[model samples]
Target: MIDETIEEIREMQTHSSSVVAVKATRALAELTERDYATVEEFERDLERNVGALKRANPSHASLYNALQDVLHSVQGEADDLDEARELTVATIDRVVETVETGKRRAAQQAAATIEDGQTFLTHDYSSTVMEAVELAVADGAELTAYVTEARPRFLGRKFARELAAIDAVEPHLMVDGATGMFLPKCDRVIIGMDCIVEETLYNRIGTFPLVAAANEVGVPVTVVGSGAKVVDDGFRFENEIRSPSEVMLEPVEGIELENPAYDATPVDLIDEVITDEGVLEY
Candidate 1:
């Protein structure tokens, strides 16, 4: 059952964005409800399952961190299966609550940075970024958003649709390659991060080039995400390589296709990272 749950998580992470940590925490909670003869058995199985999940998606540090919180929650308190189960559920609640609260706080901080009549450029689809923009519009900032049609998935199109639905903002969908052409006219760049390792922000594959273009044009770039996405020093975060079929459906003779799902952006290109705690200047 634990193995099956881990497989579900793997499938979910492949198609979803930024919700892997919350899903993993809930999966662990489900494990705790199952019947276990001994506490040792439960711990052993939990560790093995979490190890499998970590192997499945190494780019997301939040999964490992959330599972670790669950494991530590019952370290000395679980004398029986019921105690262990309760502790696991409690940990899941705390982790989810903390993540949601942090996102809300980060969104508010990000929104505060927006100015009236400014044109903001964004890439890919990020719930945190959307929330921040929504809050800024609510605050009476009449803004224009230049959204990239992030390729392979076109998640940015979805983001553009959401932004267009808002009455206070105007949204324009542009091809990813047009970033260089548009950056010079934009006031600022707002993006979302998948993980923060040291001084680098890992996000959608096109983000690095977008940041470079923004930098070349002297446009300030801000990243909005939860503090939980930050990784410890010396921890390595792998970039997930997606299937080439996502980029091309037909077979090409002797031609190779590369489809990297994410890319890394150095801190020098970023002006600020807004988190629940506050705005972190880079």
Candidate 2:
């Protein structure tokens, strides 16, 4: 089960990074259930598995942080293997709870920034941004959302469908290239990030250009996510290169095809990052 979850995360089968972190952390808890001859043996296995999980998706700071919390707890001095195992399980539960709670609070902060009768341009699929829109609407704010196609995956289709379910949001679906064409009509550009490492926002492939266009049009850009995504030093961000088949079912004879899973957007282009703590002015 642990190996399966790791593969799911590496393959991007999990939609949200927060969900990825939770699932990865819970998978490590499975390790605690196994029989170990000594506390040292259990700690050894834990470290090995933690390294593998982090390698599955290095761009996921939440996953890295969650696993780090568990590893740190288990590595502490314990009376016996049983004590170490119990501590590991407890740490996993605490980390998962924190990730979920932080996400909800961040969404609330983002929603508070939404004013009634405002239009937003969002790229890709972001559960944080989606929840913010829903919360704002529930509070009686009418909103309009323009979502991009987010090509190679069409994640935006999922975003648009969810927005359409809300009674007060007007959802518009457009190709990724049409961002500039519609930016003039948008009041803000709201999105989510995989991680913020070294002050750079790593997100969906088209996010950099979208944010750049939004900045050019003088529209404020807000990134909504948990603070766990703000990675400190020692964690590296690696963008996954997907299969070319995702971009084209049948490749042209001589043309080279490249499919990058994410892109880095400079922090200067963003107006603020709203997390569980509050809005962070960059």
Candidate 3:
């Protein structure tokens, strides 16, 4: 019964702006499907893992923030179901629609059109990229792109899978460890922001590296974010990196781990911030 409750909580978080939703869902799913002997046993393992998760990346803060909401429920604490559900649903729905909706698609299509026949590199997974690529494919634009795996969680797989479906979009899987190695090859690099701080952007954990590499290679970096990420002139970005234990988890004792949530890219590294409404040049 507790496992069932946990899964629902996992689902709730996964579908939110908190990207950890994906991994948390995976963890909870694994717990429920495998069936731990007791809540204490499960809670012990969860506390251990979540503790380690704090170090691997920066986004873990949000993951923990979202996880807190989950744990609160598991402990039988009551939440304002109507208000909470409404906020969660709206947050996720805006992000989803930001990626797949027609108005946003029109904007993406126009942005790509501004620089027709350009090759670009994008970091992590973005619905914005998918929409832009589809539009480019239909318009017969020469759009070759590179993607970073956005490691630990590897949300890049979703981006690659979706990119493959749209013919004419040449997408390369850039290894997280070696994304810098290929920077000079692309004309432009575009990243989607999970959060924008002041004018800076917080993307996946390794986004800082990509921005530095792009600047070194003299390639202009562009960002795509819904207006929401731009908080106060500068965007507020929270990068989450997950636990190193994600690399290995054993039922045995004496093992230590740390996971981080996300990373941030400064606004200076960005040449422009493209949104559905238009562009914000930083």
Candidate 4:
């Protein structure tokens, strides 16, 4: 079961970084149910599984931090196998709760930033962004959202479909390359973050260009996600190179198809970051 979860995360079948972390933490909690002979054995197994999950998606700081929090809470603190298992489960529960609550609060804060009749241009599929849009609409804020066709996966199509269902939001599907063309039509560029390492924000591959275009047009960019995405520790972002088949089913003989999953955008291009804590001005 844990292996399946790890594979789901690694294959990018999971929806978002927040969902991935929640799924991972729940998987770790389930691991405690298995029988173990000794505390040492339990510790080793826990470490192994945590390492595997972290490696599954190294770009997700939330997952890394969640696993590390569980390990630290359980490691050397339990006197027996039962105690270790208990500690691990408890820690996983706390981490999952914190992650979910943070996401909810952050989404609410992001929604609050949306003014009535504001036009927003967004990239890719962000659960937080989706929730924010829903909340804003529910609160009677009419909005227009331009969604990019985040390529190789076309996640933005999914986002656009969801936004279309909202009566108050006018959703427009835009090609990824046409961001510059659409920037003049937008009042703001609001998106989601995978993680922020220092001064750089890493998000879906097309984010850099979208942000660059938004900056050029003087459109304010707002990134919304849990503060957990801000990696302050030793966690580093690892770019995933997907199968060329994802870009094109038929491989070109001499053409090298590079499908990078994410790209780094300098924080300077972003005007604000909305998290559970509050709005952070860049």
Candidate 5:
């Protein structure tokens, strides 16, 4: 019954953009009503909730890709699920690969602006940023990189672990709130974006603060994103907020709450946006 509900909610998340998190939240709420009092049950419930969350927002590429991962993981051993996941992962990999062709552009631009062996700071976990770092490392640049532990999900820990596993760039894990403390240690800032407006990029919620801090310190920040993430949003800004349950599993009665998933770094904050074709300044 729980799996059935999860599948249904997943479909709903696929079709609906605004309600993914809410649907995921309610599904877990229902599971709790079943008196799923065991730790395993709670863990399963948590997974489904996050899965639904991925289904919830398609506008944000990272979250949507994360949702695809959830589907693949839940049924990893099943032939059908494995096939679907492979196809999806392949598609994303192709897109990332194609976009990363622009890294040369960044590298060239970076050479003009930034020297080798310069440390940098970034908030949110960016696979694009990782790719760039890897490219720079391959060129023998010992760059120190800071990744934020995007909390409520602790996705940043995943980044730190992956970086350590790479045996290349230096990856430091810092709480989102403490990014300002380390901004001075880096030469410049770089982040991967899910979407770009002008030169600005949209990413995880706490990304805005880090960008702002970097800007105030007179550091140039670069945004890297794929053209596929570009859509006519028809708005100056878009922010994806997460479910309140992410922060409060058990809230006080009658208390209002808001949990947002993401925010934007204004176009003015970014120096340029790097894409596959080349780099753009908007």
Candidate 6:
């Protein structure tokens, strides 16, 4: 049953929105309530399940932090399996509440950076980024958004549509390759991160180049995410490489297709990171 749950989580991580993936992963903590003979057995099973989830979506620091929070909370707290199970369930509740609250706080903090008559460039779709922009619009800021058509999945198109729905935002969709042409016209580049390792930001595959272009044009780049996305310094991190089928389905002989789902943006290129706590200057 645990194996099936992990498989379901793996699929969700690949296909669902990040918020959905995170909430679904938190639900897995309930597995602790199942029958177990001893606390040691429960711990072992929980660790294994969490490990599987980590391997399935290594780039998601928020998911890792949530599981780690629960794991640490239940450690050595109970002598019996039933007590351990209760403790794990309670910890999961706290983690979920903290995650939800943190996201809202981060969104508000990021929105503070937006101003009227400013043009912002963004790549890919991020719930945090969208929420921040929406909040800024609500505050009566007139803004323009230049959205890249992030290829393979075209998530940027979805972001553009969302922005177009806002009366305060003028949304323009451009090809991913044309970011350099558009960067000079934008006041700032605002994007969302999947994780932050040390000072490096990991995000959708095109983000690094987007940062590079913004930097070259003297435009500041801002990253918006919850503090939970920051991973410990020594944590081993790996990028997720997606299937070539996502780019092309046709079979070609003797041709290799590389589909990297994410890339890292060095700290030097980032102007600031806005999180639940506050703004962090890089």
Best by TM-score: 4
Query: Which regions of candidate 2 are displaced past 4 Å?
Result: none
Candidate 3, which ten residues in sequence have the lowest lDDT sum?
A: 9-18
What is the C-alpha lDDT profile of model 5 across 1-282, one tens digit per residue? Answer: 435545654333332221232233333333333444444544455466555555444445433433444434433332443343344345434434433444444444443444467888776566666666666666767767787888777767877887787665678898888888888888888876666644456676788888899888888888765544444543344455566787889887899767666676678777877765566675
Please give the clash total of every predicted structure, in order.
0, 0, 41, 0, 7, 0
Per-residue lDDT of model 3, residues 69-181, tens digit only: 44444432214333333343444344334333433643464456535567778777766556666776777775677777776667787687787776666778867877777
Candidate 6: deviation at residue 240, Å?
0.7
Displacement of residue 226 (Cα, Å) in model 2 is: 0.9
How far out, in Å, is residue 197 in model 4?
0.3
TM-score (C-alpha, index-matched) for candidate 5: 0.62
In angstroms, how far off is 90's CA in candidate 4?
A: 1.2
* RMSD in order of candidates: 1.9, 1.1, 9.0, 0.9, 11.1, 2.2
Write the residue-wise lDDT of candidate 6 on 63-138 in tens digits: 7777777777887888787788778878877888888888889999999889989999999888888999999989
- Per-residue lDDT value at 242 in model 1: 74
C-alpha lDDT of all candidate models, in order: 0.82, 0.91, 0.57, 0.91, 0.59, 0.81
Which portions of model 1 show Cα errors greater than 4 Å?
Answer: 1-17
TM-score of every model?
0.93, 0.97, 0.62, 0.98, 0.62, 0.92
- lDDT by residue (158-265, candidate 2, tens digit) is 999999998899999999999999999999999998999977999999999999988888999999999989976878888888889999999999989999999999
For candidate 3, report its TM-score.
0.62
Q: Please give, for residues 1-282, the per-residue lDDT of candidate 1 as tens digits.
A: 456656765554433334776777677766776677898888887777677767767777777677677767766778888878787778889987877787788889899988889999999888888998899989899999999999988889999999989999999999999999988889999998888998888898899999998888899999988888877663478877877788899869998999888898898789988988888888
lDDT score, residue 8, model 1? 66
Runs in model 5 lying further than 4 Å from the true structure: 1-56, 61-115, 198-200, 232-239
Please give the lDDT score at residue 77 for candidate 5: 37
- lDDT value for model 2: 0.91
